[model samples]
Target: MLDFTSIVMTIAPELWLALAGLVGVLLGAVFGDRFNSFSFKFGALSLFGAAALAAIHLSGGESFGGLVRTNTFVNFAKVISFVLAGVALFMSESFLKRHETIRYEYALLTIFASLGMGIILSAADLMTLYMGIETLSLSSYVMAAFHRDSARSSEAGLKYFVLGALASGMLLYGASLVYGFSGTTSFAGIAASDMSNGTLFGMVLMIVGMAFKISAAPMHVWTPDVYEGAPTSVVAFFASAPKMASTVMFANVLFVVFGAAYDQWQLIIAIIAGLSMIIGALGALVQTNIKRLLGYSSIANVGYGLVAVAAGQEAGAAALLTFITIYAVTSLGLFAGVLAMRRRGGMVESISELGGLARTKPVLAVMLSVLIFSIAGLPPFGGFFGKYEVLRAGLDAGLMPLAILVVIASVISLGYYLRLIKIMWFDEPTERFENTDAPVMGTVVLSAVVAGIVFMVFISELGTGGWATYAASGLLR
Candidate 1:
């Protein structure tokens, strides 16, 4: 029998976000254009509230008769998702206002998406996972096409919907197979079942489905188009929070439920990781559009994080968390900088448009450069430490080859990152980009840069008290 109180406790954070989304919808219906000014603030409030609720439930337990579980790991991921959603919302306000497409629906969809992420993190059953994925995917599809007037935006939405639906079908088919073979949908039940060929095949299908969600390569065809076509603010949200939730969910399912079959799955994950790294590095070199470049960059970064996950050990789990934290902060900062790049014509996406930015917006140039370098995993920044931890974890797990490949990919990636920096600093000044005053975005970029630079302090402190390790332990338990 499931306890009512336990069920309520398990879903508290999601409930808060859902309620907030409803309120946003109602406000939009009632106030129309008048709601634009309040949408961002409301959205931030809801996300923060949900994040606090999730934090309070860190000492989680199974609920709804084991269909859902909440623990330090789930809570941690949910909090990060909520906070990132809020940051994305804050970053979007200026962009939306500038584009004259400011709608309360954007804020509403973001909150709902965060709610979906919370569900995914807490899910303990295959059905629950699918439900969460659909919720998140549906909201994201709509948000991508929010600018209905733009042909590119509409195309982005259509492509995402079609691809996402296919992925969901694959996931569902895998779930059915798992259920048929193991006679259960619950993680604990699945873990207890004997490993069979059918179960392994099912797991592979499920992984392929999730690979699409995280924009891992081969399944990453939609990412560049969507990133380039979708509104910049929406892409920022898409790249950060959803990726974090999906990646963590992938780790949870593999490490917790499929631990008995580690050898079989490890190779699969490693191959995917290698492919993503190579594709992302080489693909970005020729990209003219900044969003498409970052889309590829995201794919490569996912590969790096997966290296830790493939380790399938406590150190690897800790490293995965650390890497994601750094990635989330830096990605948000990068997109925030991108959002600030408006000119008299409109928002600029071409890399060439950023030439001579140093002359006109020197501060923005420096911030963007720091973020790019950090993404390249250069020393003295959080990205370096993030990569170090993951690579070290891979080495400890005896994955020398994968670690080396990651390093090579990182080197390859530096070419484009540096190219961007050179254009910003050394190229002759062009027509100055319109001096849009996006104070919110500026603050976000500054804060992220500061955080990235100082994150080593947190890592040092981790020696005495291993929060990441503790969180990883919860997942295994």
Candidate 2:
């Protein structure tokens, strides 16, 4: 049996988060509106605290009697989860206030979701992974519908739940198949299994299940609708950190658990990745809703991230890590830019609404232009570097055909991104493009813009150091 003390030490950061969440929920229940200001600040601080703990505890490994594992990859995933969770909290504060519900419970749910993500990242066994994912998914469904007054919000939550449940069922069945064949759910056990009867079927089922969760193609039908319907802040939450967790989990299952059967699954993953990219790029082209456009774009991004998994090599793993790190920051920047588009009226949701935005909000227009170019994989931008890493890894794996398809898909993606830029700069303004000022929101928007550019420019040189490398290394294990 593993030492109980060892498991506690290993998962201390998660423990802290759980406790903080519970405390916040209780305090919020008792204090009500009087607690709004305090709860918001405290929740943000607590998430920040979790991040600090994750950073400080990056050294220890192996916990929870072999059921839970800690390593560089999981640790890094934890760090990313905490960091993104912190950002979501900050963004949500303003969002909740605007919606007339700044309850501490909302922040607590997010914190709990972060805790769940950390659990999933560190889970060594399939059971633990399942629990973690469900915890996170359930909390997310609730957050999606938190603004229950809006029918769109309720519909988004319901759709996510139904689809998410189906995905979870597929994953669970796949896990059962593997367990029935190998008599164990541990990654080590799966890797060591000599039996081969259901391994391939199990792998395919498992990949399909994971693909659904990550919103990869063929199973990505629910993504755009849900994203468009959900609150913009919640959409941003779904876009960034969870993808990191799912990507890491996919690598762990495919590379660690099924390493012996790499040849069998690599081709399958490559095909999925390739199809995701093509579908994502093409589907996004016709989308007028900006969030829906981003939804399709995220599918394409996942496609690129999955290429590293398909490679099944250390360099590919490292590249995946770096790619996702850059991806999260850029996505956050993009979402923040979208949120900043509101003028004297409601949010500008349509792509055509951006016509001649450069004429008035020149600063925002410039930032949005940079973000769009970055997403399109233009040079000197983080998205460009991130995509490059994934492509390089695919080439190294000798998946030349798949790499070419990725390039073609990226080229197609340029249509929508460039279209947005053109409308922003060159097209005539609609009657809707009136003047307004939201100082705090504008500052937040500018911050994301500055962050995206800084990371993109420096990732090549500075990405090799500190938590980034440690973060990359964490994924390999």
lDDT of 1 by residue, 96-208 (tens): 88788998888888988888898889999998888888899999999999999999999999999999999989988988998899999998899999989999999999999
TM-score, every prediction? 0.97, 0.94
TM-score of 2: 0.94
What is the per-residue lDDT of model 2 for residues 1-477, given as tens digits with 9 covering 90 to 100? Answer: 657777777888788889988888788888887777677667768878877777777765676667788777667777776777677677667656766877777777788888888888878888988899898899999988888888998999999999989988988898899888988988788889964869768778888888988899888998998889888877777887787877787887787788789888888888889889999999999999999999999999889988988878565777788788777766776776677677456777888888878887887787777777777888877778778888888888898987898899999999999998888999998855544335335534554464467766577553545445665565455
User: Model 1, poorest ten-residue lDDT window?
Assistant: 456-465
C-alpha positional error of residue 252 in candidate 1 after TM-score superposition, expressed in Å:
0.7
Write down the RMSD of candidate 1 (Cα, Å). 1.6
* Position 120, candidate 2: lDDT: 83
Off by over 4 Å in 2: 1-5, 431-452, 461-470, 474-477
Task: Show the lowest summed lDDT stretch of 10 residues, model 2.
Answer: 434-443
